[model samples]
Target: MTCSEWADENFYLSAESAYIEGRWETAPFQVAILNSMGNDEIRVVNLIKSARVGYSQMLKAATGYQLQHKKRNGMILQPTDSAASSFMKAHVETAIRDVPVLKELAPWFGKKHRDNTLEAKKFSNQRQLWCLGGTAAKNYREKSLDFIIYDELAAFPEDVEKEGAPTFLGDKRLEGSAFPKSIRGSTPKIKGHCQIERAAQESETDFLMFVPCPHCGEYQSLKWGGKDAPFGIKWAENNPRDVWYLCEHNGCVIRQHELTPHFAKAQWRCHKTGITTVDGYEFLLNGQVSETPESVTWNIWTAYSPFTTWERIARDFLNTRDDQGKLKTFVNTTLGETWDDETGEKLEWENLYARRETYLPTIPEWAVYIAGSVDTQDDRLEIKIKAYGPGEESWLIGYKRLIGDPAGELIWQKLTEYVDQSFQHASGAKMSVGLICIDSGGHYTDEVYAWCRQDPMRRIPIKGASVYGKPVANFPRKRNRKGVYLTEVGTDNAKDIIYSRLAMQAKDLTKPIKGYMHLPMVEWADELYFKGLTAERKKLSFVKGRRVYRWECPSGVRNEPTDLEVYNLAAVRIAQQHFGLDLDRARPEGRKNQSTKKRKSVHQSSWL
Candidate 1:
């Protein structure tokens, strides 16, 4: 019989009238379920829809169709026994009392048990609809039904190892008959669970509803809630008007207009218009039509009622700006798209690149060179070799990253390699070998100091420099004196040199000094500036007089290779003091005899 005739005889008269007058859209879900069941080829069907979207009514319709046309036992599983009872009372009982056609088909409709089972045999077609709680472990054992409907599958409880109750029931239903068609439907709870599973198994006949776009004729699924669209009201203006016409494509110019036929044909196109596989189900299930709920749509079926206007949304987006006049976090979370960071501060990659570019090529050859720096975990040693030119330019030449933690024999080996390479690069450069800074800031500091004292490499004239700004005399006195001839210098003095060079470079930013001798120095200096170490200061006491403030270490936390830059600066200072490479003019008096001070402990400073 026609839907109108069947509805008139079996359902509420008002429902029949609504159907006849086209007041309701033909429940696409009902047609999908019916077609899948009648064909016998589709054994599973899963439905998902927004809340209050007439899913229950569609299920009732499906139940009526099954009762009128086929003799088959089916089970309807609800998340709880209470819900199952409510379904029976609201849907099953109402259908029996209100539908004359269903009464004729099932004479025992009102006379069946409401708790677990209902059976009717008086009609021409004998069938039963059993209700069960989804949590009941034994419910599947009691039913050899041709059909099963699992509702609210998202909340089904099961062992974490197993799929869930819906899949468990689906497996059992498959055992009943090859032609059995089961329906599972629920709202999504997570990315990889029941909704995802069922969506994975859908077929072409599986109905996915789409509202056409008023412009561009594209079919789009509407996204009405979540962090992006926090206005939970489903409609645009909250006036029971349709508001589903926003374009999903980035940079689309379509705006919300009154639902019209011309606009309907332009927006909202089905994602699976020609595809024919269960695999395509995932695309449709996860797809959202609008990035925000206030989007415009064609008037096919208003997913949201009482719509909000686009102008208000745009204005809200604009007004919610940060102190910088950029969108605030709320705007980013709601309308503007930006990656969220847990830390309040942003790490600027451009700054890192800029610093690296500025200091990589300007190191000079005629200078005193020394490699120094600290090491972090995984041999990531920040080593820098500094050389002084004829003037104020201190060339930070060689920066090396040694593998592994900063301590131990491996570091010494890498240091040796770096020194050899640096010396070769600066061959014949007349510069005194001064202090090689070694950071003695942690547990390994004593060991490093001891190694510097005991190793034969001490004879190579490499002085140990500390990273933290402790006095050079404060470090532990060395007992063994047979290895590398090491002298300790306060890192404060080293930082002084670095900051001085940085100040000079900053002053020359507008018209940067040219030549390869200036490039690496400028680049390293830029890195220091970016790190906020634009200057260094030190409070000192003269042997006979008053306190004095001298340029100390550059300000800021020392990162990788920054200590190396300090070592380069120190070497340049030493070369200027002794070798004259960093001096502005020839010393009137011949260079004073460069006396070697006792290898004092290099004070650790915080410059690096």
Candidate 2:
């Protein structure tokens, strides 16, 4: 019998512990996952689930079944040592004490059992069950196992003791067993980072929890509101408890009270059409897709949970709609899906390079204004020069890297010379940088200030503000200890605009009317520039029930190119607003001496 079947036959819920016991039949979705343990072909079972959905209970029941029936050694890994110990104490011990069948067959059920402890338990027939933390050290190298269970996989650190992913190491323990099984489960946390979601996407059979409609009896998965969703939870203007789920098939209203009856008829549907079974569990399919039998992955949301109510979920959604933190929790624990803090496309170096133009680092013909940005580093300084045309259209005029210590004058001199130099425009007119914004949030703060004060051009010291959802430029927040005024740049706002512009699918190097990033020739475009441009991604993180947008870069990825471009864009903005640079107006032809003529006449009138 499968683990769920075994639980139905023997496992009993303690009144002090469970609201419902021996109710495996209620969660038909979990039956296949639990039963797959006995299938030698299905080596791994992954459950990417929502919170309070009996996932933990299922794991505990599976462990108990393995100890009694298979009599095989198994290991269960939690997120941390403390969590592992708590699971052993609260759930494992209680199961041995309360379950009548476990007490009758397991040798360690009694109080005087010598082989049982908090971490490890010895069962009849020399069987053993070990409860270990995800980071419980490499001590398991010597221990062989028949089965492995990884719980709360998203919470496990990317690295354990600098060795590697904890789950990867846990699988090694089952190397000695011929028919080893690995069960992975977790409530997903972050997009692109959730282990359970990753495993599910790679699984051979991706299963979604489905329930039959009371009216038409057509099976469909419960959907949180989306473009394709026809039926969803509808509530009155002011009453959350007045919630009802709409059936897409029949357009019938399934009241909150109707969930239990419908849940009894729930089943797991295969995404692809085929007739298959994993050790007697039925999988219905419709397409002519071939099956690769190796792993079975399941996804379950709280919408189908018996312990939860539609009204309560609606109320929670209404309450958390305005707050990021609560909304993230609602998505992860309620919807059983990862939340995108900021929905945007990831930067790819190849894609950006594919749009490269033939123009060199020199200013383009459409140039109306030019700006410079510098990013300071310990060993070098990164510089980016941009030229703006009509409608805020811009091109990467030049890029330079000056190697030296920021504390020394070697790199600073190079930066000064670069900014002072003039680039010949397509009109044969010389155009120097109209504005230069050097980052002042580095060790060279005082140096940057002193240099800006001495510069004869439009150079200014600037710092990035930590505030989110603000304008790209704001009034100075506070001055440095040296009494130097610094322009505060809203990096989050700037990045949002930059990403939006980068997302534009341009056919050529010509800039778009509204917002577009123009790239230069192949000489100026390289792999490193593209890497920095697409290095960081916008991620949504929750704090105190509020959503906080974070610009995160993976470890070992350099984001200096992105930083330099942001500051450069900020400089162009300052020039447009404060310096009266008309980015939308084209520079007039044969107007090189217009300003000079006015100045000469004014000088003659003053002499009179």
Candidate 3:
């Protein structure tokens, strides 16, 4: 029997571990991913996934298939001892206790209860399923198994007590078996450092779930569309509330509800122009798959989750384009792509100054949300307010430096009033600053922290880390001595995204492009504005024989404009993540929270 078929017939989900508790039924999109684990030809299967995508349950089903159906000895290992214990309780224990087939074949009971331990489960069929702790090399030593399941491989330590990579140690255990197999899955972390990504790259085949377009019945992978992407997924410039997908083969508007049960009409495709073979396949680069290779590895990314929408993804992209860290999460978790930091762009004050538009204080017609950032000094506090629109196209609407002792309450109060005031969008809509990020790394840290503590949702305290790959926005819950959350800003990471976007200065002022920044010809952004914003240039230097990139300004030049831009970008990210700040639909005034509830519509994708 097929693994998915076995699961459907006998598997039952315990209420404790699963959100949907019932008879185990494989989702349509999950059929290929689950079956690949049971496929005898494919000896190595790896899944790079996002959360809420049934990977945990998929692993459980695969384990049951190995023990009950095939009667094979296997092992499942987590990253840490605690995590292994937790998985045993939440997943393994429940499956055995609830499912009748699993219960009858289970080996939890024996004299002195030696077989039913967390470390290992001995089945009645003379086959044993070992549960190993993630850290120690000793756990992998005694296990000579037919197959191994590496759960959350990214979380496992790179080296187990300096023995070697945990995966290598596990692979050494499989040499004894004739048809040795391994399965590893994770959501991935940073690029060049992700375990799951590296494993998947080694794989011979990379399969993307493709669904047929409702209109033309042509199979195509769903793409997040913009200028470069003309089809697949599309959204409005001002409202993601009205989002839909464009059929790649035909220009058919498939509403969000029309995509219900994406699995029922979906199939896995690995090549741009040909069929997929597990043991040997090609990767599509620049729209064409490369030569077919030979190996025993299969890679799968559950790109479309049952609950995920093109609108949510589109809005997230628009909301996070200005923030590198948040955009990295979007890329990793949503797009299932590794993020590479590329932040080298030359900036000239003359070019930036000349491109200024003839606008006063009024917000641009395209702007839908607003954010403010502050740079604190001993003598003054510098603030810049930027308005954002669809695809993160932004305008520098205001910049002001309040001259006063930052330690005094007078300046802080002024700052609060300034941020609290509303601005008029060209559409006559009003907008309150969605979020304000204040630099608390300076001498006035106490005052900044205290003020931010009063209203953390809007007034956020920030500290620049300049870490290479850290996200621009994170609530590490690192509280100050005064009991205030001090947010860590990845200034270097944010600069990478900022400069890349700034480099894409659109020549045509009317065209709205993602990451394009617009400046006004106002007194606030006068002669020094461009100079301050362009002060810092990317400088490459060798650190311990390794090339490292750092943003450097001339010794005496002021770069508060660019610094404030990072803070504001982080502010927008914080707002998006913590405060539901959707750039396409999120509004601070007169606009209510857009209902994410899937609207009722005819299921047009199905053909009788």
Candidate 4:
């Protein structure tokens, strides 16, 4: 069957009415694209759209066309099972029931349940629509498919290399077809993935629904401008009449113009231009859109909904305001902006204490030995002590927010004393300092690093710890020594382990260990998971032929406390591995104290 034949048979005239009613362009475009795809000349079609522009319906139309006209296996893969079910139930069923041609062509369409599989037949050809999740992509390589649809392509898991690429799946489906057409469509979610690949393959069309200028004969795309464009309702208020139009070119002296009787007769146009580029989407410092030299075409579809009222958006901003008058999720997601600093309210210290208290009693007696992390700064030191069992359970024993010059000998004295005192409190078997992960992140790290490199009375074990693994060396023999202990620690490598452990634990959603309860850590873990950086590994590179490793922190935040927190966690992990501590056991034998006053002195000077 030809593309036009299929369109004439099944495409609904109501689709045009929907478009005219300023509802969604999905119904019309879906029918049009399905008609185009039935042609042998069209190999692929890409759709780029603003939010809520109805790409889902278009996808369903393409799927329906394949089922009715083609006699081959079809597949639709979504990033998740839930999304696939929603798409099938919403659009596929709508097409089958509402479009009379499809109901007559494929009798089984609406009868299928929203499960893993759906089957239908038209004439003598058999068609199957399987909604598989991303995980099943690799296992289906043997199936010859006639059609493939990737839904919510951007939100596809980052491990596409493991899950398998949608393009590869689409190609595999087209293998035996005499005339195969693969249609891809998605809103811009992130910078890369299926949307990017499809956009790269096709010529972009600026799908502007135009309105005629009242005073001039020119018909152009309409946009909110100046005080008329003021956020939300201001644009509607300034232009009172919904007929205002402006020239697309910036810096044009043209002002607000009305639609006149003669000019209103022109038709809306969708111009085929070049592909959309990343730079075309860049916003200016003041939050206005910027114009760049790169000429990329966009199928720009503005919302048919009333111009978002500035008052409405402003009220949304005010409603989400924190104590500091900052809009929490509004400024980041709605405004399409980035933050220069971490502006959201930090988790309250009291809340952290409360969560910690609930989990404290479960600490096993055998996990008495503690590992400490010291994040050194010029003015103050951030210290964290954690207790771990032989297996998975770990606890945050104690953390100190200490003040005073971190570089001074007195801080080290205080740290050493704190360690000794903590051991004394846990006195039983042996309470020994297993590992100390110090942050050599700043310019003055050398001084503290040298101190850590020094032997601690043959009692407290001080190992040189990196993110990836631990490297051991003797304590500094002299105070002025600089060569041996100073080494670049890979922060990324350490964070990878910390984040992986946290992710695994989060998936279980069980209560955490008792001694290590910290509300702040839980909040940080949540943020990291939401940003999809939970198990992300560090990337290694070469600059000037020298090896370097880097880490990307979770999105929507900075990397200070998280870095320090991971450093501490890594130290405890290393300690557990080194000592063969049984993390799974309810109680393990505690470490025996080998420290005298000298050990105490060292502890006081290092971390207090």
Candidate 5:
């Protein structure tokens, strides 16, 4: 019998653990995942899922099915011992008590059987079902198993004291069996760090479900799209009441009820498994789309369980869209996707590239003053020049890389020439670098200080202070031992300012708003530059029992663009403190000369 058929006949849901308690029938979408547990060809099954999808019940059913039908020894590993104990009471033991077959297989009744205990259930056929917590290393000692179910795999401790990941240790337990099978499932959390996601990507096949459109009778992968997409879930004016799904194949208006029965006809196909496409469209899945729900096709079929509806998912998105942490939860729990902390919180590189204006080598018409930021590196110095208009409106005027060692003077001379070069404004006026901040947080700190010491007012050395709530620019009372005035930059506060502004330009915004960043359409402002700027994600974690927000740039990801932007922001603050510079009260374009002729001043005043 199929796993689903066995489950329908044997598994009984308990009142405490299930919303609707009765005979357990696996949903169509869940059938493949449960069946993979018994499929010998598939040694490992990973179900990266959303909540309220009956995953917990599948774990219980898989246990009961394997115990009776297959009679295999297994382990149900949970996050903690308490969770295992609770699962045995609320799920496993209840099944033994409510179902006659399960009771006959593993008796937990009035008989005082020592083998049938809290964590272990030894059957008459010399097979055992062990439930243990994955958090403790000792739990994995010397137990041989046929199958292992990793429940909430993401929540399991990453490592037990230093032995290794719980997954690695758990797999060792099933090494004794020839037909070893493992199942791992969880609702993913935190992009790039989701354990189930890693497992799914590494597994033999990653399956995606595709449902047929009832009206067209044409099978197409479901999509959650905006009003403009080919077809998917679309709502009017963000109203959940008006939410509906448009069929991908026929553009038919499909209500939540129309797709119910058709879900049973859904099929799981994965490109990685060599099932390439359906009807010329790439094999796609909804949850794999970008952090933005509308990036690609939406899998309304993903919400095909009897418990959830398209309107419900839409309502949840609407409720949690404004808050980052809550939105992360909604994506992880409701959408069955990983949440990128910067999804709605920061600007996408492609969108930033799309908004590029043709203004380059020349400052914009409204630009007032300029600031330069240099990010020192091992082999190069990343430079970014920005112009600010009224209200701190910023434009990325120039980007260049000095490809050499900062320890040498040749690259410094090149940078000096570039800094000394003049940029033209639209009104026949000249603009020069007003202030420059050289990052002293690299290999050549003394070189940075020496360069900045050339002109104290215009060039200054700055170091980043990651302390929370620190002011963006806090000038020290005195210079360091090197006799160079070093500025402490509050990187977190600066990121807050920059991120809040970039949030307005996430994807599409036609008009210029306050503090909107404008990029130039030039060779330097390519995809690499934009990716660097958007590389870091602001992640929230607790350290010492207090909430700490830290910017995380994955290993090998270039973050110089971000660092340069932060340095320029710090330069602005320092300029305001040391020089008579004003971003809000921008000087009018025309000079106060009675000649009535616009004359350009090649020499910028009070700038480094």
Candidate 6:
């Protein structure tokens, strides 16, 4: 008997299951994908599906069938250890306890029970099913498996701690098996990086679930329609309940109540030709056998789900279409597709260097406020000084490197001297550092705190926070070990802003009201500084089925310059909001004498 057939006879869905019954006919398309396991010629199956669409549950069903009927050793890899543990408790435990056959076969399935543990289950049939996290590839080395299932393939780390890619390591386990098989599934993430999407593209027979139109008898797939479409949901003015699916073939408007019956009779069809496969109409008719060694892939969405109605989807679309966070969720979860971020593009260092201005040991006339940031490294402290003007137009006036251990007192003194001094502008006015932000997340945490505590109003210690949608600078969090309140700088937001400004062309700088970054000609000429500034590129990532934007750098790339710039920009924001300091306005009378001394030092310094 096939895996889906066995699931139908003996499998029972627990309360945690989205589809409360293990009936193969209701989702015949999924059954066909699972049934492909019985084909000795086919070695791999890829299911790229929407959330709550029975992807993981299908794997569990296949596991139960293999344990009882096929009796092959297998493994399941989740994104992380915590996620693997949760999946074991939530799905694996429930399946073993609820399914009568699995209970009788895998009797010792519990904590501290010898035969079955959280990581592995030993069935009476002498077959083992191991569940592991994908982060540690070392664990995947010694195991030989007949079957393997990778859950959320796109969420796995690109490389596994010097061991190499997860997929390559998993494939190594199949080397011993005579007819090895693997199934990879994910909701997908970014286009280029999505593992499941890549696998599906490589598969010989790619399938899409299609249901016949109740009125016209034409088979069609669900699509997010634009102006031209054969199948898409349309709604009346401000009314979600009035949502209806427009059939492209016959123009028949199918209501929400009519969708469930059609879903029950859905079939798998070829994505390219729109022709139904041999198993497409098996439920409505008799099965037809075919012969091929090609691997198979299937794509399904929430439109076929009995749990999520069309009206609810329409309402969700209406509320979240305008907000990026909510819109990303809707596109990823409901639409079952990846969200492509416009800001996740790489910026060329050459393009930015071309916009540099003539070098001077001073700020320009457009400069209003002076802010500096320090990046703590084990070998040195990298400092970046930026001058800000109206609309946050900024110039990189200075970049300094103090070569010494950050943990030592010598580096701290050098950083202080650079921060305390001022630079002269072409207008002959001196500008001392209005605000300074130093990294507090390195080995020199205590040193950073000491500097910030010396003058809390101007010098602030900051730690980068990667939470999505965080403001440029969040409210100060708990005091550090040194009892100093540290600011949480939103490095993600700063990168988005910086990248947008970097994308600006040299000709576009003359445009008014645009954020312009002016680079120093000589300072940016250094190869190390240029590499550090453009070290990281923006990329899209999926976290818990939501699209997240993050900055990613290739290994061995030095991104201290990028981090320092983020800190400097975040410092200006904090100064404006928390300290009521305005860079666009003239300096206060109380600080005028300090600037005179600072200007004099600039002229006398040897480096100047």
Lowest-lDDT window of 10 residues in candidate 2? 599-608
Instruction: Report lDDT (Cα) of residue 414, candidate 1.
Output: 66
Q: Pick out the ten consecutive residues of candidate 4 with the lowest summed lDDT.
A: 274-283
Residue 40 displacement in candidate 3 (angstroms): 1.6
Cα lDDT tens digits, model 6, 1-608, are 76667777877777775455453332645667667654456688787777757777778888777777787888899999888888888888888888888888866755577777778888888888888899996769788798888999989988888887787789789989987878888887766677777788887767777788888888888876632345588777677788889987888998867766676676776655434553422322124444453577878777776657877877877777556587767777778876675354567777666666784776765566788898888899888888886668788888888999777788788888988887887558667877788888988787888878887766778887857667888747455667676888878888888878767665534333336777878944576777778988765554532345678787999888889889988888987787665544532323233455443332211211
TM-score leader: 2
| Winner on TM-score (3 vs 6) | 6
Give each model's whole-structure lDDT.
0.43, 0.73, 0.73, 0.45, 0.74, 0.74
After the best TM-score superposition of candidate 5, give how far the Cα of residue 266 lies from its true spot, in angstroms. 1.5
**What are the runs in model 2 whose C-alpha is more than 4 Å off?**
20-26, 110-114, 226-230, 272-280, 284-292, 342-362, 365-393, 396-424, 427-497, 500-608
lDDT of 1: 0.43
Q: Please, what's the RMSD in Å of model 6?
A: 15.0
Model 5: number of backbone collisions:
4
Pairs clashing in candidate 6? 230-248
Q: Output candidate 3 Cα RMSD.
A: 20.5
**What RMSD does model 1 have?**
20.5
> Comparing 4 and 6 by TM-score, which wins?
6
Residue-wise C-alpha lDDT for candidate 4, range 264-298, written one tens digit per residue: 24332334432212222231223444332121222
Backbone collisions counted per model: 69, 8, 0, 50, 4, 1
Q: Which ranges of candidate 5 are over 4 A from the true structure? A: 110-112, 226-230, 276-302, 342-608
Per-candidate Cα RMSD to the true structure, in Å, reads 20.5, 11.5, 20.5, 17.7, 16.7, 15.0
